[model samples]
Structure formats: C-alpha cells, structure tokens
Target: MSQQLIQGNEACARGALAAGCTFFAGYPISPSSEIAELLARELPPRGSVFIQMEDEIASMGAVLGASLGGRRAMTATSGPGFTLMQEHLGYASLAEIPCVVVDVMRGGPSTGLPTSPAQGDVMQARWGSHGDRATIALAPGNVQEVYSLTIEAFRLAETLRTPVAVLYDEVIGHMREGVVLHEPTPEELGRRTAPRAAFSPTFLPYEPDENGVAMLPDFGRGYRFHVTGLMHDERGYPTSDHVKVAELLERLERKVEPAVAAVPPERYRLEDASVVLVAYGIVARTARAAVDLLRREGIRAGLLRTRLLWPLPAPALTEVSSSAELVVVAEMNRGQWALEVERLAGGKTVLAPYLKAGGSVITAEELAGHVRRLAREGVAVS
Candidate 1:
C-alpha cells in the first residue's frame, strides 16, 4: 500500500487507471473537471486513449463506442453535463454497454453553483434516464472511499455489462486526505463475460448466462450483432415483440439485483439504538459525528451510511428502521433521498428529514440540533 494525500477527484482518476481503464472521453465541468484532467495527463503515458469531446452527449457516445471496441472506458461531469448525457445513459442501459460515469455534484437544476457542494443530483443519478431501468450508483463519503468505490464502479460495470455511476459532492471531489492506494488484484479487476461458444450466424449476442448478463463480444472480434437503443432480442436485433420487450426490461433489472448485497450499507452503532440517522456521500461524515454527539447526550443514536445509492439496500434499511423509534434522513438536498427512506421506513418508526440546499452541506452541529429538537418536540424538522 502506498500512502499519500490526494484529492477525491484525483483518487477517482487513479482508481480508473488501476482498474485497467484504457479510454476516457469527457467535457470539462466544475468539480468533475479534475477527473478528466488527471486522466488526460496519466492515460496517454500508459498507452491509453483520452479525448475531450464537444459536449457531454458526445462524450458519452464516444465512451460507449470505445467500450464496444473492447476498451475499458469512462467519463466525468457535473449536474449540467450529467443532464445532457441522460439520453446516452438510457441507451447504455438498454444496449448493455459497460462504462463508468463520475458525477462530482455541484449545485444544480441549471448551473446554480460551480465551486460549491451539494447533493442535489441524488435522485437524478437513478432516474435521469427515461424508462424503467436499473442503476448502479456509489456514494463515497471520503477521499479513500472515492478511490475504492471508483474501482468498484468499473468492476460492477464490467461484470454486469452496464454503466455504473460514481457520485460525490464538490467538497469530496476537491478535499484532500491521506489514503493508502492499493493496486487491485486480478480477481478484484473483474473481466466482462465474453461469448462462450464459437461465433456463427446463429450466435445470440444478447443471450444471458445463469447470472443474467449477456456474453457480449467486442467489436472487431469476429462477432457481428445489432446494437440499438430500442428494445433488442437475444440475438441483439431490434425487436418490438411485446413478450421479448417485456422480458428484456425485466432481465435488465433482475441482473443487477445482486448489487444490493455486493455493495451493502454501512451499519454504524445500530445494534441497539432507538434513534437512527441515514445519510450518504459527504453528508454521511457529518451524520456520523451527529450520532456520536447524540449518544453522548444519552440519545442512543446510530447511523446507517450507505455506499451504494441505487438498488437502495432495502432490507438493511428496513431492518434498522424497524428497531429504531426515530429515523432521521439527513442530506444536502431538498429532501430527495429522504422520500425513498420514508417509503422504506418501518411503520412504527417516526421519520424526520434534515435537508439543506443552495450549495451548503449539512453540518454536524446543525444536524444534531435538528435531531435534538425532533426528539424533544416530536415534530418534523424543516
């Protein structure tokens, strides 16, 4: 292990290189621009390809194309650019292209703040793309996790044959921390599943294995198949047949279900607590501190910090919520993910939200104050 102080965005770039990513295409965007900049400086030296595209849409298109050509590819951007890439995100989901997307979140909805931090993109990461599709989004609370989760994002993308997103706020993206950067072992660096049988005219490029991921052959690898944003059949050809379309969508979702366990939530001091706080990304650090403050004040507070955003870690959430009398969902947004927690929360637990926006992070003192008020007044904290 090599220990050094590094910024979160720089750690993400190094993680991608460690994961064997050989291609990158992205547009310059605040907070996330460092990721693209670092990759540009490092990739070419390692014989990898890096390009600054015209825009986010073109960047995503180039990434998908590179992945199809058998290169481990990725791109990085912020809220505005992320919005532009939604169309390609949907296409990648339906087409089963393996790539990584890093979203270093800044204030949003329309270039609200470039240098400030906010978690406004939480819901967008999962639902920005149209239609019913599964999403794999990882949230790292610190610089070390930024490195680890970035590598995990690429691993999941390859094994599941889908795009995986790495999300963090501007604070996390730019903050520097001491971390031991470890190289991934061969097994840790997962490989995409390739076609098992010899390629022939009868080959089915979209046919799934028992794991539900298709054996997609790389382009120029003597395997030819159709690729489109429309619903596709087992042979990778466009198919509007109702049964095939329905099955395709269902399989797309079902295949990624294993991610729930593969990337489980971090349960902290939840073994026997009456108050539980839920948070992720940079807010999670503050929330954890609030838990300690509450515990010291005789509040029996615990925290559930999720590393994986999508596929929601429902069971873990429900189990913790069931045992708690109060569940506080703290975030750096206008109650985006809190809505999901409210839906999954146990019927017996009282849920409260501590939300902040306008490019400010939820501070530990502020969160603890809100929880103190909520615990005493039994009213929701606005």
Candidate 2:
C-alpha cells in the first residue's frame, strides 16, 4: 500500500483508474470537477481516453456508448449536471450498461449552493430516472472509504451489468486525508466474460443465464446486437409485448437487488444499545464521533452507517432498528433517507430525524446534545 494525503475526489479518480476504467466522458461541475480533471490527466498516461463533453447529458450518453464498445467507462458531476444526466442514466439502466457515476453532492434543487456540502441527492440518485428500475448507490464516509467504495462501485456495475453511483458530499470531496491506497485483489476485480459462440445466430443478447445478467458481447466483436432504451425482448430490440416487457423489468430488478445483500451496512457499538443513529457520507463521520462521546457519557448510543444506500440494506436496518428504542437519522437534506429508514423500520422502532440544508453540516456536539435530550425526555427504549 502506498500512503499519500489526497482529497476524496482525487481518491475516486485514482480508484477508477485502478479498477481498469479506460474511458471517461464528463462535464466539469463544482466539487465533482476535480474527479473529471484528475481522470483527464491520469487516464491518458494509462492509455485510457477521457473527454470533456458538451454537457452532462452528452457525457452520460458517451459513457454508455463507450461501455457498449468494450471499455470500462465513467462520468462525474454535481447537482445541476446530475439532474441533466437523469434521462441518459435511465437509458443506461434500461439497457443494462455497465458504468459508474460519481456525484459529489452540493446543495441542490436548482443550484442551491455550489461550493458547500450537502446530502440532498440521496433520493434523486435512487429514483431520479423515470419508470420502474433498480439502482445501486454507495456513500463513503471518509477519504479512504471514498477510494475503496469508488472501486467497489465499478466492480458492482460490471458484476450486475448496470450503472452504479458513488455519492459523496462536497465536504468529503475536497477534504484531504492520509490514506494508504492498495490494489484490488484478483477476486476484487471484475472479469469481463466474452460472449459465448460469437456470430452465432442463436445468441440472445438479453437472455440471462443463471446469473440473471445478459451475456452481451462488446460492439464490433463479431456480434450483431441491437441496443435501445425502449422496452425490449431478449433479442435487444424494442417491443410492445406485455409479457416481454414484464420479463425484462423483472430481470432488471432480479439481477440487481438480490445480489446486493452481500453489501452490508457499517455499524459502531450497536450490539447492545438503546439509542441508534443512522447516517451516511460525510455526515457519518460526525455521527460516529457523537456515538463515541455519548458512550463515554454513559449513554448507550450506537451508530448504523449506511455504505450501500440503494437497496437500503433492509434486513440489516430492520435488525438494528428493532433492537433500539429510538432511531435517529441525520442527513443534509430534510428527511430524504430518513423517510426511507422510517418506511423500512415499519413501526419496529421510533424514528427521529435530524436534517440540515443550505450547505451546513450537523456537528458532533449538536448530534450528541440531541440524543441526550431525546433520551432524557423518556422516549421509551423498547
């Protein structure tokens, strides 16, 4: 492992390169711009291609095209740029294109705050695209985790043959920390399997084997295959048949969610605690500190840090919330992930929310104080 002090955006760029990403097409946006800039500098030396697109939409489109052409591709953006890429993001999901998207979040809902940090894009990352689809999103709490999770995002995208998002707030994105970045093990790297029997007429582009992922041959690899955003059958052509549409939709979900159980949530002091805190991304660092301070103050407070935010890691969340008396969810947005946590908890525990917006962060002192007051107010533990 080589040790160096780097920002989260820098780490994400390095991680993508380490994961064998060969093509990048992205627009420059605040906080996320560094990721694109670093890739532009690093990828070329590694024999990779990096281009600054006309906009986020074109960036996403170019990424999908490159992925189809057999390159590990990615793009990075912030609030406005992410919003612009939503339609293409949906297309990638529907087509099952393997790519990674990095969103270094700033305050949102029409360029709320450009340089400040906020976790306002949680729900947008999951459901910004239209129609029914499943997305895998990962949030890293610290600089080192930013590196590791960026690599994991690429690996998951390849393994599931779908787009995976890596979300970080501006605070973490620009914050520099000492990290010893290590290379992925052979198993950690994604293996691109060649399509069986190239040029065979019997080949089905959307026909999933046991893995529920279609065996798609790269473009120009002797495989004449069709790719489209419209609902299609197993041959990859657009179709209006209800059964074919249902099958394709079902496979999209089946291929993504079931396999996500392997990605577990990060926990701290939750084995035996009356109060639990839920947080992710940069906010999670403060939550952890608050938990430690609460424990020292004789408050049985624990933390459940969500690294994998998309599938919601329901089983793990349910188990933890059911054991705690009060579950407090903290985010930079007003109850985005908190709402999801409440729905997942399903009345198993009391859900409380701590939200901040307009680019301000929730501090450890503030979180600890809230927990102490909540505990003192006698909010029945169990």
Per-prediction RMSD in angstroms?
Answer: 1.7, 1.3
Tens digits of per-residue lDDT, candidate 1, 139-169, equal: 9999999998888989999999999998999
- CA lDDT of each prediction against the hidden true structure: 0.90, 0.87
Model 2 quality (TM-score): 0.97
Q: Which candidate is the best by TM-score?
A: 1
* Model 2, span 1-382: residue lDDT tens: 5689999999999899888899999998897889988889999988889999999999999999999999999999998898898898899889889999999999878978999999999989989999987888999999999998888888888878989989999999999999878999866767655566667777788777687888787899788989999998888888999998998888888788853565677889998888899999888899999999999888888999989888778887888778998999999997899998899899989887888887888999989888888877888342
Alpha-carbon runs more than 4 Å astray in model 2:
380-382
Using all chains and alpha carbons, the TM-scores for the candidates as numbered come to: 0.98, 0.97
What TM value does model 1 have? 0.98
